[model samples]
Target: MLRHQMTIVSETLMPADTAPSAAAVRSRVTVPLRFPDGYTATAEVLTFHGLADGKEHLLLALGAWEQALLDPEKLDPALPDAGPLVRLHSECLTGDVFGSQRCDCGPQLREAVEKISATGGFLLYLRQEGRGIGLYSKLDAYALQDTGLDTYEANVALGHGEDERDYTAAAQMLGALGATTVRLLTNNPDKAAQLTALGIGVTEQVPTEVHLSPANHAYLAAKRDHTAHTLDLAQPAVPSHDEMLARVDALIPRLRERAEETERIRRIPESTMEDLREAGVFRVLSPKAVGGFGMGVETYVEVVRRLGRGCPSTAWTVGHLIEHVWMLARWPRKVQDEVFADGAEPLAAATGAPVGQATKVPGGYSISGRWTFASGVMHSEWVLLAVQHGDVRLQCLVPISDVELLDVWHTAGLRGTGSNDVRAEELFVPAYRTLDWALLGAADNPGSRIHPDPIIHTPMATLLNLVAPAAALGAAEHAVEMFRERVLVRRVKNTLEDRQADSPLAQARFSHAYGLVATARLQWEEAIRVVTASYQRRPMTMTDHERAAYRLSLGLSGTASAEAVRVIMAGSGGSAHRLSNPLQRIQRDVDVLLNHPTLTLDPILEQAGRGLLGLGITVPSF
Candidate 1:
């Protein structure tokens, strides 16, 4: 014997000081509500009277199809056995209708509807925009918020309470629907407490996840700290780069395990290479038109540096591979299409020194000679070899099938790179595959005309000089990590109460090493910023002085990185010098990278000094 009659909750409990006079009330009518997220629910719109200012406000009883099956003739008995989910949402047109980033109201509303639609629930859509101060007043409060006033203070400045919202109508609407108990969904505990005071049973208070962004961090923080909202404000929004870097960081441990194996095999492990490929490492510098990230030099350097922190050999190989893609973009449009046709991203190995000979032919050039230090030759499909073609220095692209790999990468450091010699004996290269080396530094190139990204227009020498140093920077950072982990705990052999990290001598050494690494990073970043700025200006051009300055920075960065590792090694004990320790390997790798002809300080300094002294430009490396 269930009753269909609606209950009349205590209206006498209304605040005696500010209770409104009773007015006419209207019956609810069922209507359909739909959302862009493909959720639909039936809503019963109820208009209430006796609100303040003689204004009418609406309440909505939202439910899914299963909830609609409840018999209206026996509403009480047909009510859900468990209390329904409920949300007392104040209307925020700015956040709800427009995706404003100032607050989390919009995301909360959307989340509430989605949850309610899935389970049986009610949404008391109260028309109390700006917490009852109205829309116009809320905008005024926003101006105060911009002037250093918090949300609550801004509301108080507008002559309103921190919160002026009343839940009496919400209680009455739930009584009309025969909902005695509800699971409240809200971050504010006050909402649940208010409902309980109105005789509605709040079974559970479910805290909503706060939506945080850079724009609303302060607002959310104030609410969490000052207003007692249950929110985890400690977590900052993760940047886009962090997602990529996290993947790289996770692989560092595994890379360390395979470091010795990689060097012994004279190549990266197949599994490690697969991991890098799956993580989209090689595609970072690929043109966007061909499904590449088309990222700038800053990101390029950062990625290489992070990878180097794992294994310098792998990082060195990856750096060159990515740089080769940038080089290919300077080739003719047909070559770019052929290389990236059908969304193909081919790994390429490149060497800038014009060490090969090329003879002119009918539609291309007959190339011959050996290009040394072709890193990652085993993994690359194409080889970009610099050749002397008559009077012009040309970068000729040939398929790996046309070139033979010679295992000659046996070096003191970066041995895992397998930077073997690539020999091409009389290979015919199409004219479209050859680009003048000088054109890469100029504003307009064949690929630049078709691929409009400014990254393609970057100076070739500036980009080339960055790869080796970036790997060195990563190795330097690894050295720091190793030193901190080992030196902090190692006890001095002969001295009592003395740890390596505690010794004044060791401290001075560590500080000096850290300073050098920090200076190198700053110098590298400044050079990259300058290059990026030039690329922004169409037809990217750099004066001889600017070019020489960049070259000087590159050399200095390498020197600093190598010197930092050396300094750290000097402080590291005999244990660190063991063949099994990574510090020794890092030292060897950095030394080898620093001694590179292009990265050497003297040649770069000479070029820069001549430019500064207004001497005739003899060096073309800049």
Candidate 2:
């Protein structure tokens, strides 16, 4: 169906036909509105200037669908749309207004236009250059970019906040446009909270993810690490915790039994996947308006952690399902109706590593090529795949019917995950199924439209870490249980005249390891508490966000596991290294998880250091 159907005639630029009122301005600007059936009204440009930072700043405004969609420019309650599609965009003088390629401002702006143009949306373009620190400072940082400084460092060396953008002007602009609520499109969380503080309820966050390039790869990491942008290049699309656990509870025994079969076939049995469907695990994260559970992140995280107790692969798979659903939740209702009207589950898996292209077409784009490491393909009814569209990389969701799953999930660990290759030839994905890669990570992600919690707005990749720690914590707990029991009855050969538990060394090791695991558990709980606290508050501060990200990186990422391992190994003794021991598996799994890009020690240390010392930390090589 077509969206907004208003003609933006050039004459709309005429003044409001009234004398200057203290509260109103005779602004002149051209705007474009889209209609259903893929038709668009003639485009017109309107010049609207408003007070920003006590100075008049010019704004080129475009008006789209005003019914049922939140228009950020409108503030009157009576004229408000049923729901607002809010987008908080930072002013990019170099790219947005001027088409510069040094960054993704132009591409993001174009993508935002097309998306909002499709539906009724309010794009609040705040005049904060270079992520809020003006353009001159950005350029100055660029000049010093090669001298052992990341994007954040370069900005700091130039004497500027890592990010200095504010949103008061955006709120005022929304009020004037009769937009009361919004579905924000951004990766920056601070922007979302700021708009909410102004009484403009941000219903969702539309993500705008950008393509990775040699020029901006490191720059992107700075956004994720220092600025708290939420792109997870490692696992492009995955499920949330709630979805994963529900699937696991229903599929546990089946999966456990199927493990032997999985080993033989090197893939999860199709029947096991079917078992998950009957369980409703896949739909919990769907948009509530669409009849899905619409559970919050806290519930979802707990569910995944509980499942992690039995199997890490299962927990991981469940997380992937929920995150993918989180992405699907951001689609317009019309789109949502088409995808989930049947109330059937949509199983999706993604490979974070990008490799392929999606060529734009009339109604949508024709996506093709092979993508590897798709973990849940054996079970998925749909797949959200990452593809490159020219220099711009995008995420496209496709029905499983459109693609073929290749059996190639052989690995030393997580062997039963069935993470194989996904091959598709010219799969037609409607426009609604596609999302801009960079924008999705931005602070004001559109998915927050239905799920308003900022925790839901947290980066998709950062959420993936929850699974690793959940599994590690579970395994660690299990190992502790085993060690305690073994030492109670098992006698040390010639070295000790009594059971292992009677030895002072054994007692000391147990005490220490138990303390470490307990501490790690507390850390995980503390992190979850912090995140949940922000959810109740709705709008979090920059300091709160920084602390939350740090908690994830420092505590849950690897620090917790590192401490747990020391205790576990010390208490278990040399015999724990045997292949038959679960201790060996727990240690190996934790070790492998530590190598994850987000959880590694170097970046975590850097981030903690910067948070403590007022500096910036860049993502390090894993």
What Cα-based lDDT does every candidate model obtain?
0.77, 0.61
Q: Please estimate how well model 2 matches the true structure, expressed as its whole-model Cα lDDT.
A: 0.61
TM-scores for all predictions: 0.61, 0.53
Expressed as tens digits, the lDDT of each residue in 1-622 for candidate 2 is: 0111121211132133321211123354566644322445433232244445653433333345444343424543654444555566677877666545457776676666666655555555666777677778888888887676888788778888766666666665555554555667787777778767655567776688664432455667677887677666441233556445555565555554554455456555666555655455565566554445566666666665655555556656766776676666654455556666445345577764656788889999998889887877777767878889988778887888788888777765566567889898888898888888765654456666646534446555445556666666665665677778988987887675479889888888888778877877777777667555654553432353455364554355356655666577766668888756656655665666566554566656656666656564443211
State model 1's lDDT: 0.77
Residue clash pairs of candidate 1: none
When summed lDDT is taken over every stretch of 10 residues in candidate 1, the lowest stretch is: 1-10
**163-218 in candidate 1: lDDT tens per residue?**
88887777766655556667788888888887787667777788887786546777
> Could you tell me which 10 consecutive residues in candidate 2 have the lowest summed lDDT?
1-10
Please list the residue runs of candidate 1 whose C-alpha ends up more than 4 Å from where it truly belongs after superposition. Answer: 1-242, 342-344, 352-354
